[model samples]
Target: METITFHSYRGGVGKTVLSVNTAVQLALLGKKVCLVDFDLRAPSHQSLFISSTFSMSPTAKSFTGFLVGDHEPQSVINSTDKENFYCVFSDIEIFQQKESKVRTKLTQHGEGRILAKLFEFVRYCNTQKFDFLIFDCMPGVTYRSLDALIVSDKIMVVTRPVKSEISGLRLVISECYSKLEGAEIFSIMNQVENIKDLVHPPNPLDVNFAKVNVLGITKCLEESSVPIPLLHSFPRVPFVTERIYVLDEKNHPFTVEIETFCNKLLQK
Candidate 1:
């Protein structure tokens, strides 16, 4: 199975929205896809899929349970009503406990069983004929996030047009390159207000991210210079707030963009 992980150096950079939209776009293309929520500390994908219909239950069968060996990984697969998009929700409380334990062990052995469990989960998905496995990684370069990066085939770093965020992206790149060695890495610029006028914006913070390959709502997807050019940019639409929670593909601007992006992925 091909694994694509969406990561960011900091939180609230629209990583989850991008990840979920990308997965939905891929699914609409008739490819079998699984969107796994590896952001154990703050799980939100489940709500996006179910429209807040279901809360992440902190039970033995949840992702936290699976990670802590309290339950089988297979038991954590929760199928959303969305076609070709199954989800694995995380339990924040359990994740904290397990992550702490895993981190301590990694310091001594340079390894841990969590990675093995993640691999096993991937293998299980492969057996089920999943064409793509999209991981929505948590922000930051914690041990949990690193595990996701290690297993990912391609890493997409999401960022905003801000100085601090861009600095964080550089650090994220450094960490990923250090651990992933030669894995494919790409960047997606989020919440871009204007691409043309960015040559000299009022906010100096925006200038820092100017060096990286960027995608904006104003640019045509086919004309993008970035490797694995952005699939689509949402364009600060008010409807995105309402559409993000709903599964209906027609009303959502992000969903439409995702569909277009998915077509591009298939072309690859």
Candidate 2:
């Protein structure tokens, strides 16, 4: 299993959206993929498949349960409608309450008690024969998110074109990748208006500091009311009323870009 962690300096950069879509596309391409919602604090990967009326199994019975030994890690792995694709969601209820303790246990002793258990989880994932394992790590520099980054084979930093985001992005690159000897950082710029803009190196001054090869840049497909990426957005169709259906609009601009990005990711 090859692990990839999607991280951002802050939220609202379409990190989860891109992770969800890329995982699905990877599955569609015949890779046995697992998308993990490791964003423990405000876990919302379920929102991708959720709608006004539909709900998934509660988080207490999810991955967060595995975090605290409430359930076996294998039990928390849930299947999606897409074949060969699965997801593991963070437990908002338990995770928020236990985060500090979890963080301490993970980081205090350098591969300490908590991480030892989590490594068991990773070993279990390795046995599952998955081709691609992806994590939607929580935004910012939390200990838990950093732990995930440490375990991943590749770190994809998702950022936006805004000034504030760029500043933070530089910090993330300098602190996390510049001096780090082992990990390779992949840069993905989101919410750009035009593909032409990507040709100019984003945050040119930090190119040396980041040490990341640009993977791809995607356009923002957001609407006013939703205030989130439109890649997961679904409207009421003829038969489906309340459920968010799988996106099959191959010709939609957003879908086109997502597929293109997925292709680029595989090429790299």
* Count of clashing residue pairs in every prediction: 0, 0
Q: Write the per-residue lDDT of candidate 2 for residues 1-268, one digit (tens) a residue.
A: 7888888889877777678777877888889998888887788877655542324443335776576566787888887666787788776765455557754443345444445556777788899998888988888766677677777777777776555665576566555545445555676666554423355656655543333222211222121111212122211122322122225555655556667777766865
Task: Return the TM-score for candidate 2, rounded to 2 decimals.
Answer: 0.73
What is the C-alpha lDDT profile of model 1 across 148-229, one tens digit per residue? 8888887787767555664565566556544575456666667665545344545655543443334222232233333334
- In terms of lDDT, the best-performing candidate is 1
Candidate 1 is scored at a TM of 0.76
Q: Where is the poorest 10-residue window by lDDT in model 1? A: 215-224
Distance from true position, residue 132, model 2, in Å? Answer: 0.7
Give candidate 2 misplaced runs (Cα > 4 Å).
52-60, 95-111, 195-246
Model 1 residue 248 distance off true place after TM-score fit, in angstroms: 2.6
lDDT at position 18, candidate 1: 80
Evaluate all candidate structures by whole-model CA lDDT and list the values in order.
0.65, 0.64
